[model samples]
Target: MSRASPRYDRRVRLYDTYTRGLVELPPPPGPIGMYFCGPTVYQRIHVGNAIPFVLPLWLKRWLELDGYQTKLVINITDINDKIYDAAPGASAKLSTDATAWYIEDTGLLGLGRPDVEPTAVETVPDQIRTISALVDAGHAYESDGDVYYRVGSFPEYGRLSGQNPDQVEEQEPNARKEDPRDFALWKANKPTEDTWWDSPWGRGRPGWHIECSVMAEKHLGPEFEIHGGGLDLVFPHHENELAQSRALGHGFAHIWTHNGLLRFGGEKMSKSVGNVVSLREALDRWGREALLVFFLSGHWRKPLDYTDETMAAARAQWTDFVASVYDPSEERPARGWEALAEALEDDFNTPEALAILHEWRAAGQLELMKRGLSVFGLEIERVEPPAEVNVFKEARDAARAERNFEAADDNRARIEEHGWTVRDRPDGSVLVPKP
Candidate 1:
């Protein structure tokens, strides 16, 4: 298979968790195929779930703008223990409803959607065939109506997770399992489970790991450039996925790119941890712009603490960006664009890119600011206000010039009543649509 040459001659390097070092990507307009593991549709996803969603979308945006033809596939795990436990007999309905909510809430972020969004339930047949292949190849077995992957049979089993096969802790201990460390490839439908798909092993559902392995290959083929998800998936989930795909003579993901988890206070925010802040809540409270700025404030590969204070800071920063965009100042650092490219190229270091963006803003680089912010979907546009609103703004400016503080305040209130606001900048006051 031949890869495409770079149209813009741009390249990016990412820290592959599997390789434990930096890895340069193939050249662009690569038609680079990347897979991302999205959330299980058990309930409303938290702001933490948005990290993997946002990071990869931004990466795609950046790469495509830099001349890469990229295919980004984010999968929804509709069949999981969490979904079954969260809704029991009505799990299918919950998965359907929750999947819609997941789409709606993440869609609010305004980052472009993935090229393909595959669902786990839709890939059951492929999963069953892969499991059968593993069984025939002596890498898996059927026991008690369940299928388990043979951990010791695959010599490279723990290479990705850095866990010794012998010392690996029990995943799901079953007396019928060939080894305690072996994990399920197919889980036999329990009395508690209402959703079941028939396979050679019996009426069962695909294991979480196998679902990803099948869905990823179904869309991106056996060998793809990158597989992405939250940093926490490095253990059993990704390791098991890697083992399953490779056992069938597939190369699997060349780079395991895991974005850092979003933490609340000092702990990871998860429904299990009970510190979850729903994405809907965050979008409603802080809005999409502030939430995006908050995401950009931290490097994608590092933990970012979610706090009211941090959100407030992001809001303030977004306000400044909005104001800075319309400023007429032409002064800009000569290396501004180069600096941004260098930062992102080094390892998709968004935090560094953001810092350079602020420098562009501080130096009054309006065009540069627009170019950079567009990469992250922070769209800024200059709009002409209604004639009546402009009249109020003009009145406000006149009152301020004449030292009529009372009249100035009244004009400000009038401007707000018209659903617009005045932003006072160093150049002068400007009319902006209220955020």
Candidate 2:
């Protein structure tokens, strides 16, 4: 695709976790393929989980705006130990219901759905094939009924997470494994479990790490543009995926992007930790624009704390922006939009982009402000005041002109009762909806 903006004209640099630095993405011959690690459908996804989900939407929108067709794949992890534990006798039913709820909740954020959403249950055959290839290549082994990836066999195992292989702790300790750090490619089905799939080894389910690897390969092919998830997945999950895919002789993902975790009270918000805030609850308390503005206030790569003060501040910021909307026909400078685009081009620097937006709004560049806000997926609707509101406003204006200060104040209070705010200007007053 042709580059539509100078911001994406082969000059933008995105940070890759593999390289540990900013690297330029080569112009793709076709659509850019992006794979994001999605939810494990054991329960409702919290706000922290939405960061990875929403960040990719921003990237996809920016890329498409710059004339690049993007294919985004987000996998639903339906087969996992957590799902079984959460539902006990009805794991499959739980996953199916949770997956549907996930779609509904994220849709509330107003970001469009991904191009492809493959489930682990549907892609079991592909996963079994990948595991078989790994075993044949001697990168994995089958013990009893479980298949484990031999960590020692992959020489470059620690490059992605920068952990010394010898020093890395074993995630799932199994006495039957050759090495302590060896991870499962497939787990043997337990007699107590209800969900099971037929594989070469036995009736079992795919591991968490292997699910993403197989799903990405099946949908986006072996090579893709970007692989993204939360920073928490960097160590064990992504590190294992890197080893397993590369050992199978495929260039998995060119750029590995990770968003910082959302925190509450200076600690990572986790359901297990009993500190999670549901995405629905947050969106209900605060509007979608305010929630998005809160996310945009900080850098995507930096951890952001969610607190009442921070949320209130974001609400105020959004209200202020909405209040500033004026005549779209008014002429404004274009420099602000250019500055915002430049910031976004630099590894999606949202904080810098937001600062430029504020500067434009303060400078009375309402048209430019509206355009800039739209680029970040914000829209400012121009609402017309009701006739009764105009009547009160005109009464206030007349009272002030006649030097009736008490009457003017009373009329202003009456307008406020109608859920409108009066912003006095040198020439006249502007009526804005109450924030």
Candidate that would win on TM-score: 2
Query: Per-residue lDDT tens digits of candidate 1, residues 1-435?
Result: 555544335568999998899998887677788999999998899998999999899999988877788899999999999888989799999999999999999999999799999999889999999999999999999999999999999988787888887788789776988789899999998999999998887798999999999999999999999899988898899999999999889998999998888989878787668888999999999999999999999988899999999999999989888866554455855465778887898889988888888888888887888899999999887778899999999999999999999999999999999988897877678887776
The per-candidate count of clashes, in order, stands at: 1, 0
Q: Mark the 10 consecutive residues where model 2 has the least summed lDDT.
A: 326-335
Candidate 2 lDDT tens digits, 171-194: 889798999999999999997689
Instruction: Give me the runs in candidate 2 sitting further than 4 Å from their true place.
Output: 1-10, 28-30, 327-336
Worst 10 residues of 1 by lDDT: 1-10
Any idea what lDDT model 1 has? 0.89
